[model samples]
Target: MTPGTPGNHGPGPGDSSTMTTVESPRARVLPWLSTLARLVLGGVWIAAGVAKITDLDASVRAVRAYALLPEAVVQIVGPGLPPAEILLGALLVLGVGVRVGAVISTVLMAAFVVGIASAWIRGLSIDCGCFGSGGALAPGAEPTYGRELARDGGLLVLALFLVRWPAGRWALDAVLTRKDPT
Candidate 1:
């Protein structure tokens, strides 16, 4: 068929309709990248949550070390953070509500970045307690705010990407949304 003809497909290898709607390589690749991002972010969340869930006291102490919130808020936030992380992470990993998970991850990372920056500015020596067992650092132990910030920042970027493009190969979101595999 002639290119651009009413019943003809837009173009063929030798045709010149110039109106084809072919997907770019990047579009094809993004889903895989998103899948990787989802798994990594999810795994990190699960690990961090599991680490702290076993030691609520230590989590509380870590929150207290920030010295930013009221005691009452601290009590709730410290114990609550781990489970929230776990839930968000599980959602991301399972590709269920991936966008929602990414949004939550972004917020948590932002909070972490703020907390680490605040601690560094105040010259407080304390472990982030991100993976668990965080509190005041021992004598001569230095706070690793730079490293923590860098890690969280990277995670934030990943989360942002997922937020932008939550469609991944194995995500439940894709299936649930009934996206056609064009």
Candidate 2:
């Protein structure tokens, strides 16, 4: 078998073009999925943060309504949460330190889940205040604990997935790691 022959189609003296890279289907799909998850989670965080940051007092009141924390603690936490969430969201959206951001996201989500569950168990009819100022519901309004939990659960899964596979296409991490970014 000679060069260019069916069986002799190996790389030539100066040509590596004949050398092919074979990838499974999963390889082509996982990164796209990861990118989607990153964007979704990041966007959610940013929106939630923006909403609460606009009204610090309302944010404080929301935390106060939970009745799960001391007044002193709530004072600090209420004011601090918006900025922290915004930072985390920016990290995720920019794909910088993705795993760390995801881990933080997971922790936050877990805390939210516990808070919502606790409110439901304690017969508290307060709003979760996830996206905006959460506090007592209107007289005729009902709490949507179940729906909030489900949404948070889904976001938690997305964060977990990002933690497992932090690298994705168009991500800064990919450039920093110097992998086959495409």
Model 1 Cα lDDT, one tens digit per residue, 7-32: 33322232211233666666556667
> Against the true structure, what is each candidate's TM-score?
0.84, 0.83
lDDT of 2: 0.79
Which candidate should be chosen as best, given TM-score against the real structure?
1
- lDDT of every model, 2 decimals: 0.81, 0.79
Q: Evaluate residue 177 in candidate 2 and report its C-alpha lDDT on the 0 to 100 scale.
A: 51
For model 1, which pairs clash? none
Residue 39 displacement in candidate 1 (angstroms): 0.7
Q: How close is candidate 1 to the true structure, as a TM-score?
A: 0.84
- For model 2, residues 1-182, the per-residue Cα lDDT tens digits are 12222332222222211222445566556666887999999999999999999888888989888889999999998888988999889888888888889999999999989989999999998999887745757678899999989999999999999888765555666445544335
RMSD of each: 8.6, 9.2
